[model samples]
Target chain A: MIVKDAVCPFCGCLCDDIEVEVEEGRVVAVTNACELGTTKFMGEKRMKNPILRVGDEWKDITYDEAVKYAADMLLAAERPLLYGWSGTHGEAQCVGVHMAELIHGVIDNTSSVCHGPSILAIQEVGHPGCTLGVVKNRADLVIYWGSNPIDAHPRHLSRYTRYAEGFFLENAFRDRKVIVVDVRKTESANIADEFIKIRPGGDYAVLSALRAIVQGKADTIPRTVAGVTREQLVRVANLCKSAKFGAVYFGLGLTMTQGKYKNIRNAIELVSELSRHTKFTISAMRGHYNVYGSNEVNTWMTGYPFGIDFSRGIAFYNPGETTAVDILARKECDAALIVGSDPAAHFPRKCLEHLAEIPVVQLDPYPNATTAFCNVQIPVAVTGIDAEGTAYRMDGVPIRTRRVLSSDYLSDEEVLARMYALMQEARER
Target chain B: MKVTLAMKPAAKWFIPIEAESIVPKNFLSGTDLRVWRGNRELRLDEVFSVSVEGDADRAEDVEVVLSGDTFRLKRVGEYLDAGKITVLGGIGMHCGNFMSGGTIEIHGNADGWLGREMAGGTIVCRGDAADYCASGYRGGRKGMKGGTVEVFGRAGDFLAESLAGGTVIVHGDAGDMTGAEMRGGTLVVHGDCSRPAANMKDGSCYVYGTARGMIPTFKKIGTVQHDGRTLIRFSGDLANRGKGNLFVKGYEYLD
Candidate 1:
């Protein structure tokens, strides 16, 4: 059986043009997807059974028992934290938020650790943004700052920025000017028309200088800022100013550094400043397929975006304070309910120590670092493979994820709904 | 009049409660105020135990004490012209958003957008504050145009971003972008700042401790003495031809 126009739930691109060949309820071949997507669709490292951590040993448990155990732990605790909804569908996230509210817990997503700084910056200096279609259609000057989409988002350039032909531009690659700014020459930089090598943690300085040059404040800027000369900065500013339409896509390189949100703020402000001269927009290179969806859903349900806390019987938000990393490191929660993310592997040592000490319930399709550490582990069907739901792209475009295969296991939404129901029933009792 | 609203411990608010309507100015006549609970409009009495002790017509004359955790309450004191609102626990997002006049004292930590687009007010968070405090919303250019926000504890990133006019003081360490894209404002951090001021058009940021990162757009203008303490003053966010001033305490020279 061949599945057409299936959305790949691997990365934030949400490439919906994939064709999957399924045989015996398993994906055999995937076409039009990157290597990462192929690996995800193939169910590599997929966990089969629900496991429970007992006396430092993993024991397979039935789905019903897993749900009961998860609910029990959540209800028993004074303060339970629900973290990570970026990998699941919007439906599951809605249920998860409800669960968090009922339990008076802290609910946060992966963005708290990643593009959260970008969100903060966007909230500060409003984003001059455009959809991927707009970038493909009108953008003539494309700048990739502190991000290597070649290795991360392999199909991004060919599908949207560099090679994709739009209505106004025939030969997109030839018609557009590509600029890459990073600490080192990356794979994406190798193919760019201009590559500006910046010193580590110098993104803010470089971005500010570029903004100064664009705003005609060059007199105040030093000849050499962040190792980039005045001539290079001026040339880049001129290109941005002269372009009919410009788009900048930044990644963790900007958010993870010392400046964090400041780097992104400078970049966004620069793009906003460029808009004064020409049409310019900016977007964060969101990593997960539904990470943007998690934020969108959380924003609609709660006034705040992410890092929400409901422990006080109301939804509260604070990034550094309420984020998963900080909350876990602080060891504030008595119990934790994690969904669709593996913080045990990704978080720092201090955070992992707190997570290990707590009673954790993890709901995911695969058994990873979190599964091994969690007290109760529930196996759910893989999104876009054995389950279908709504997912948002990196640019905040909602797309329907199609299921190409069947699975006996429950979906993430079903599991969360069941958990919510179980918790409600237990509370009443 | 002094109004005290305490949340019942058993009450778990799944739907966001918009408490902007429960300001002191609206309760002078002791009329039952209605707030939105999800899609339904419910009276304040249904969720909170409302009691009015004193009598007053103006918002500033009224004292409102909101006890318990109100982290789920959205827009706590939005669009307040005058009043004194005190939250015993943490507050949700948009706590004092668009407040022209008022005093919101949060005894506990605060969520993001603590004083979003606040035109005038005094917001004091005894605990830490989340991101976007005294900052603008998405697509907005002007942030806390005029106000005073003091966080006794740490503050998250993007503190006072795009601040048109305001005063923000943090006693504890601040995350990145202390005063970013600030057109006008006065931001003082007694603790360490990750990355102080970037792309600021006009503003003044004084750091009593260390500033982790510095933008090349700022030129060091030599040290100055303030309150018997040595401080290094720098000018320019030269990116936007901004005449912003950044003063760091016990500053070391950086080439």
Candidate 2:
């Protein structure tokens, strides 16, 4: 036995066409999964080992005891925040939102730091976007900006951009003019026919100059401008303008830099301007598979995309006001329930400073940086591995996450339901 | 009419909504417009008619406060000739982009890409700015044309690239490769810089920092400078024949 349709929730790709063979309630073999996915499938699954912090050290406790303590801490807190949900199921995400509402706490996703800029750009100017399938099949000009997919998304080029054969684009890399723009030279850049190195934070500036030349503007300087000259600028612009179909892909290099949000804003605006010439679009290289799904669901339900705050009982949004980073850094929150993300490793130095001060609860499969600092740690089954759910790919395509292995641990949804029940019980008491 | 954009905090996300434009009665003591969503989208000619007018006392109390919580607007077009919009606190990404007319100024540090794919506009930053201040996006090529960005503080990487037109001036140190694959544009860096400087076949960069190892692909050319500072130039990114030139001077970094 195996599931014909399985999904891999290892990264933002959320590849849904996975086949698995299970034996003895465990996955024996998996097909169409990336390296990270394979590691996830064969990894160790521990027991209910919920740990509690007494004063300094941690002690393993029963699930019931841990759950009870978690409930108590949450109930006692004045402003409790629930963050993260990328690796969890949609059902669990719904439960987490409800919990935040009942507690009048702030609820934020991983977007507070990582791809928050991309989300903001989308809200400003709607995205002219398509799925990966569209890129493989139709895109003739592929441009990677501030990202090295070879390291991050290993199979991106082989499966879609450079290797795979689509209906329309039979010749993959040969037909496509690969261009890599980044701060440092990367492996992906090595393969690109044209590797244009822009100064860090200079992407916005460089793009402006190129657009100026494309529109037929003349400017002369005795020396080079940021290492580039006038003739090459015109040629690159010509390549973009002549392409039948083009795609601009970028990653954290843009968002993580000093110009985090501005990077994505310019990227989107660039794609928008490219569309004026021919057919051009762009996609953010999202890290978590279900992040796009969460954004989609949250957007449809609420007018705002992410970093939501429910302090007034009803939904009121001010991204700067509701952003998790600001709330945590300012020490406005007292307690927190973190889901799938590992903020200890990813968040800035200032953000982690405040997170350490709160009474934190973590729901994760493994012991990550955030879990190590939490007061209560509850283990949960990894979505698409031990639990099945629906998630969205980086391109905003929803796919069914399949369950191949069985687990004794609680699902994220189950844990959330239990917490909600405990909260309701306390209110009635 | 003054347009007020505001966002409210919900449990999971922030809700952003643009308010209907309203005409203000006062031409002085500029009206305050708040953005609930970190990003506020204003159509061309929407806020060009309004101005911040006669509020010496009010200006002292709150120097153009645009709070994220309250959705308010200040109109002073009746008393002033030009409209001035000054953001008091930190703003979301693309704070000022694609403005054909009028001036939009940010007082605090702004997120990435200052004047994104700008056609016409004047944007000035009082604080540091993030990457891609006035560059083109990935893939389609063609960047800023007919606009200007002046960063008074330090700037993040990729100051400008894939540029077709525009002038960018950084008063402080800039991140790696001031301009990479730029086609056309003028960039002036008044501080230190990092590597792989520029890969463009076109455009001009004036750096005051030490020039590092030039890509084996780029050919050594000449040198030039403004205000008495010397700068070395090289034509490079032979990967594209780019005829693009890179200028660096002072600490001798040519590799």
Q: Against the true structure, candidate 2 has what lDDT? A: 0.67
In order of appearance, the predictions have TM-scores of 0.77, 0.65
User: For model 2, how does the per-residue alpha-carbon lDDT over B65-114 read when each residue is reduced to its tens digit?
Assistant: 23343222211111211244455444444544554434556677766666
CAPRI band for model 2? incorrect
Per-residue lDDT of A211-237 in model 2, one digit per residue for the tens? Answer: 554454424221334455556666787
- Residue A35 in model 1: shift from native, Å? 0.6
TM-score of 1: 0.77
Give me the overall lDDT of model 1: 0.84
Query: What CA RMSD would candidate 2 show?
Result: 10.4
| DockQ of candidate 1 relative to the true structure | 0.22
Q: Cα deviation of A78 in candidate 2 (Å)?
A: 2.6
Chain B TM-scores across candidates: 0.93, 0.68
Please report how far candidate 2 places residue B143 from its true position, in Å. 24
Question: Of the candidates shown, which would achieve the greatest DockQ relative to the real structure?
Answer: 1
Question: Could you tell me the lDDT of residue A341 within candidate 2?
Answer: 83
lDDT of each: 0.84, 0.67
